[model samples]
Target: MEAIAYERATNIADAVKAAREPGTAFIGGGTNLLDLMKGGIAHPLKLVDITHLRDDGLDAVRALPDGGIRIGALMRNSDAANHTLVRERYPLLTQALLAGASAQLRNMATIGGNLMQRTRCPYFYDTAFAACNKRAPGSGCAARDGYQRLHAILGASEHCIAVNPSDMSVALAALDANVQVVGPDGARQIPIGEFHRLPGDRPDVDTTLRPGELITGVDLPPSRLADRAYYLKIRDRASYAFALVSVAAALQVQGDKVAAARIALGGVAHKPWRASIAENVLIGRTLDDETLREAAAAQMRDARPQHGNRFKVALAERGIVRAVNVAAGREPAGVTGAPA
Candidate 1:
């Protein structure tokens, strides 16, 4: 790790000011940032600890008057998952959060940090590889011609194929969440769908957040899918393994017909891959196995997987079908190495 200076801001303004300095980064749970620093992937000269920003009440989860939920940035993953409002109103978010890392890590990971978590690409972590575009821009993407079983299948540029590793962000995308950010210039709202950017030409910029901007909280809009939601994760292990294919499915069913639907895929792109095309295929249709298959197929129609990860195309298809079925009350939810 490089030599660093640490400063804990007692307020949001101070935090923003500290972060404005060149080569400065904000510290949240330090779950992801610390790992990158240890790997020499991140070399910040100063750390502005904003884990206790007072302006936004950064650790509360409260119900909004409009039936939405507001989650503060510093709220721990475990607490947010178990919060009464979250469990009762955003079960898909709860399920996705629980499906991630172990209990100990969840207890330390914050909502902001989780959304800002880095990719788990092996090449991005090993300094021995000098071709990771995310690590060293313009060098090249090692995963393009290397081990790609866990790389992206959609929204990938020729320069990078790394996938976003946050299951919670996937659920947020499906829930139509909005991120509140405060920076040197003041505040702004970024729709969750537009928050994480595709790895177009600039793979180094994972999110749309500007320098010195701090994510204050997330707002989840009103939805009726709370009672009809499912999170399915498929990985190499039964637990504690990163997802190879994961789906966050939620539906609003009117009698036997689908009134509204949201499907988002993790581990398949640079950001939470929203299956909007599949969603369009299911809305107003009769909920059934055939409809589920068609919707899943629609989502996979544009997938472009590389050599070792082509199997993900099929795995994602099956997982999407299963997730939507489970969300529609036609299937049971399960966890493990296989799509549930």
Candidate 2:
């Protein structure tokens, strides 16, 4: 392990100021960053501890005046999932959070850390491998032809095929949440859809955050899909496994037809993929099996699955159809897909 320095930040300003220096990283729960550091993937000279900024309300989950909710960045995943407002209003987010990691990890992982978690591609984690574009830009992606079972099937570039490993982010994308950040230029809000980036040419850049920017909180707008929402995760096992294909589905139904729909996918792309095509198809249609299949197919029509993960195409389609059916109350919530 490398020698490192640590500083406890008193407030957001203090944290941001310390982070402005080169080779400085802000630490909250240190769930993912510590692992990256141990694996030699991330090497920060100084760690700015921001978990003590509760006086700034960076650990609170408060309801917004605009009929929305703002979750402090430092809020623990377990606490956020069990918060009364979150459980009552944004059940999908709660379900997604619970579906991730183990209970102990969720207890220690913060909302900000969860949003910033890196990919689980073996090629990226193991430095012995010399061909990981995400780790060493310009190097070829080893996972392109090696152990691609967990690789991406959508929105992938030749430089990288790893997938974003955040279940909370998938739910947030479906809810149209916004990320609040503070940097050298002051605070600004970024839409969740635009916050995470696809692996274009520059596969190293995962998010749109500026250098030294600190995520303060996440804002979720008012939504009517609370009663009709479902978060479906399909993994290799029943617990403590990363998703193979996950779907967050929320629908607004009027009488027998769908009034509005929101769908987002995880474990299939570099970022949480918003299924706009599927949403558009379901907006004015009834929740029939044929309609659900059509929506799922439309969502995956352009998917470019790799050889090892071709099963993901069918799995994703089935997962989406099942998620939407549960969200629309057309089917019961239960496990229904084969393991990927």
Candidate 3:
């Protein structure tokens, strides 16, 4: 590990000031940051410990007057997932959180840190490989022609095909939440759907956040559309595994027809992918397998899969249809993959 200066921030202002300096980053649970440091992926000259800023209500999940909720960035993932208000109002969010890392990791991982988690692409992690565009811009993307079973099929550029690995982000995208950030220029709110950027020419930049900005909390609008929501995760293992393909399905149904819907996919792109094409096709349609399959297929119509990961395109399509059906209560639980 590199020698670094550590400063424990007294408050939010102090943390913000420290982060404004070059080569400095704010630390929350240290779950992701520490791993990056140990792996030599991040070499910050100074570390601003912001975990003590919880006194400013950065660790609370409180209800807003508009029937929404504001979740502090420092709130642990486990706490936020199990909070009475979250579990009751946004069960999909809770299920998404619980589907992530183990209980111990969830207890130590903060909501903000979870959002900032790095990609799990093998080329990005292994220093031996010198062709990871995300790790070193302009180098090249090894996954483009190398082993890419878990790479993206949507919003991928020639420079990179890495996928975001956060289940929480998938749920947030489907919920249409907002991220609140405090910086030198005061504060600003970024829509959750637009928070992450695609791996265009510049795959190095993960989010739209400007330098020296700190995320204070996440704001969720009223849960009217999420009453019948579901998060379906399919992976190599049953538990403690990164998603091979996951779907977040929320619907506002009128009898057997869909009034409105929101769907997002994980483990398929540089960011949590909002399936707008699928949502648009399902509006006013009956909640049936045929309709669901059509919407799912439409969403994957433009998928560009690689040699080894072509199965992901099919898995994603089937996952989307099954997830939407389950959310609409038209299908039972424990169904996996497409019909034979």
Query: In order, what lDDT does every prediction score?
Result: 0.91, 0.92, 0.89
lDDT per residue for candidate 1 within 58-158, as digits (tens), equals 89898888999899999999999999999999999999999898889899999999999999999999999999999999999999889999999999999
lDDT of 2: 0.92
Model 1 spans with C-alpha error above 4 angstroms = 336-340
Per-model TM-score, in order, reads: 0.97, 0.98, 0.97
Backbone atom clashes (below 3 Å) for every candidate: 0, 0, 0
Residue 96 error, candidate 2, Å: 0.1
The residue-level lDDT of candidate 3 at 231 comes to 91
Arrange candidates by lDDT, descending. Answer: 2, 1, 3
Model 1 per-residue lDDT at 290: 86
lDDT of 1: 0.91
- For all predictions, the C-alpha RMSD in Å is 1.3, 1.4, 2.0
Model 2 per-residue lDDT tens digits across residues 1-340: 6889999988888888989889998899999999999999998999999988755568889989999999999999999999999999999999999999999999999999999999999999999999998999999999987999998999999999999999999999999999999999999999999999999999889999999999999999999999999999999887888999999999889999999999999999999999999999999888899999998999899999999999999999999998988887878886532243
Error at 273, model 2, angstroms: 0.3
